[model samples]
Target: MLKEKLLVLVGPTAVGKTKLSLTLAERYDAEIISGDSMQVYRGMDIGTAKATTEERARVPHHMIDIHDPDYPFSVAEFQQRTEGLIRDINGRGKLPFIVGGTGLYIESVCYRFQFGQGGSDEAFRAEMQAYAEARGAEALHARLREVDPEMAEKLHPNDLRRVIRALEVHHLTGERLSEQLKGQKKQTPYELCIIGLTMDRALLYNRIEKRIDQMIEEGLVDEVRSLLNRGYGKDLVSMQGLGYKEIALFLEGRCTLDEAVELLKRNTRRFAKRQLSWFRHMQDIQWVDVTDMEKISDHLSEIHAIIAGKLTLDR
Candidate 1:
């Protein structure tokens, strides 16, 4: 029994995964399954850097815009949905290509991570939320740092939902979230061809700043304002996403527009660094240095060869 073939493109934000993915999907007759966590939310197009309507029309895409801003989407749900999409695409004689920057989500699908059924304690979650609200997010994060430093390090203090969930998992199961992840098997049900794009750090950070500026110019602030006007609270996971969070602060008068933009750029740069760090720890990635924009065709050929050889693709 052979494993189903999966082609994955992963890299930090602003590393140009989208444009390259379009070309590869066209060439390989693949249907893309978005590996991005944020892109799953509707009405988050500008901030998430979603493929335009024109681009999406060029190739079939799945696992995007399936949820509202208030919906609570977990990594487990992402894995389940993506697995089904992969099977369906293969059934139709098309390759399944996953493209995005979300490390945990993509890695969960790639390695078939089985997150244990850690039942939630509603009271405990509420308590943690109250603690965050009263004592501030940093204080709540500090509590987690005492119990599960590794997990705390990975999560941002402002990501209160995940932080509370982590604390809840620990309280309910008496085991750290990081430990449970380590306990899971690292086996995959797919024959994976994972391509990672990379560039010089300074260059990548510059690109990230420029991209955020472009997002602002493209009405990201108004997009956040619209979601808020529709009654999506700022604390919703979707609202706390990269672009939305920063701009929401500005809209709420918590910061000036310039301050929000600068903070967004800085946070995004840190995020890209974290993304790269996470992907670096994963195994079996064929790295392509996409530092030279003029050599895109060469990079594409290089990636195509990797997929062909790894998955034994005849075409």
Candidate 2:
């Protein structure tokens, strides 16, 4: 029988999710379907923080390096791929683990939001995206609030894509995106246990800085340069990501190299803060504080018990 369970591992950036995910995969005999957006692109490794071959080989990982940097990717595509992966992995007598820090991607799977909604206002979406760039993400969200208060309440003012989408639904179909999600069939094919990992906010910030520094030392700039050399520019969806955007600014002489690095650090920290806010707002997720878990063994034991309890309940 297929083991229909989804073990979702989420946390803010730099909180060390990869190692824990690897350990959990081995422990649960699960296969991982990555929950990251940037990591899906090939030749974007160092900056995207894709796991080393050694790390990923030890635990089978899906959804990493699946696209070229020049290609476009979308949240809709992710949802479709996840639906297939869940079935394939379950058919193999293993559990499916969805792991990463991308809150929207996670929600796409967890809540199984319909990616095919027809209430798409192309003009409004274009306007909102431009507004976010010209004014700010908060300004776009303010526009959404005037149209869809319910969606505005849940989405962060800085979440550019969702804020635009919410406004688009209102302008196109004259219906709320929030209402669209309501009373709809959840597309999730698996029963799930959500795990949230965290550390002290200060400590998490330290780890993010250290990880970015390490990424640079490991040739992040060269990776971006290689992609650029191949003709991808800042306008590509892949290039719009955290690392690429800052590096592109530096290359464009909009900022000094040092300033670019500092901006990367600051922007990543803000992104992590946004990530934390998203995960924290989720009500049913069980959190494991990294500061409290002395060792992987201890952490694994607790997580194992949670999974075991789920199986027992099913029995």
Candidate 3:
């Protein structure tokens, strides 16, 4: 028997998820747990587009600003923490709502993925990092392709961390990471519901561009400057996120502000496309088109019916 229940709301970035999620949470008396990878870090509020303090005060939230900027938050750690939160919410007779665009984090918990403790080899990891540094990232990625082509195809050459992880997993287990995941009999420990939001590609891109303009006006560049001024270097993983990294280049005089803004908008649009592609291939998601709304009431009514169908609520 399942021990808890979970409601997941996911979509591409800047797709109005925050507003919609708040409404749903209030209606069901649910507490929100952020599923975003970047939102976990402190002092990253503006660049990460995290929920405002006022909004958070209105409804309880978890998993945001839980760590300093330099802390490394692995997916395994996220899974463990979120499971504990879900249990607590269920025990208290409140719904648990997981809301964000982080697909890997959400999927890991939904499928109850088991990332074993023995997959690390510090010496080997060091060796792989040194190899990439010496031979270039593409060379290291090619090495990964030689062993796990399936995993390699999904990863980009510039994503050295994940590429190194794929290689490390093979070295430690002597088996492909992709194969291990495929062979596992994946199961969910909760009664789960996943809702995905989407709209026309052109319309989504326009929203993304407008959101970037708004973020700039809201001082995203100043936010990045504040973090860097406090001595958070560009080398930290947190600094490498979308808006932070791009704006950092402008602050460094490596690019003009306009160029940086354009780059951010373009990269965000591509990121949104990739997000939609990932969700499209996932199973059991009730997708809602935000463009279909002539009235806010209509959209909420549709969402309410969908959630009511999936969840057993006392109200």
Candidate with the greatest TM-score versus the true structure = 1
Instruction: For candidate 1, write residues 1-315 as lDDT tens digits.
Output: 767889999999999999999999999999999999899999999999999999999999888899999999998999999999888888888999999998889989999997756887888888888888799888999999999998887776777888898898889889998888777777878999999999999999989989988998999988999999999998787887888888998998999999999999988887888788888878889999999999988998898789878996656
CA shift of 115, model 2, Å: 2.9
Q: What is the C-alpha local distance difference test score of each model? A: 0.89, 0.79, 0.85
lDDT of 3 by residue, 1-315 (tens): 655889999999988899888988998999999998889999999878899999998789999999988887778899999999999998999999999987768888888887883458889888987897798767998999999997776554545666788898899888897787566455777787889988878888999999999999999999999999999987566776789888999999999999999989987887787677667766779988897546679878888888888888886
TM-score of each: 0.96, 0.86, 0.90
Deviation in angstroms for 113 in model 3? Answer: 0.6
Q: What residue runs in model 3 are displaced by over 4 Å at the alpha carbon?
A: 127-160, 171-179
Worst 10-residue lDDT window for candidate 3 reads: 153-162
TM-score result, candidate 1: 0.96
Q: Model 2 off-target regions past 4 Å? A: 1-3, 123-163, 174-189, 312-315
The alpha-carbon lDDT assigned to residue 130 of candidate 3 equals: 85
Pairs that collide in candidate 3 are: none
Deviating ranges (above 4 Å) for candidate 1: none
Write the residue-wise lDDT of candidate 2 on 42-87 in tens digits: 9988887888999887999999989888766778899899878888
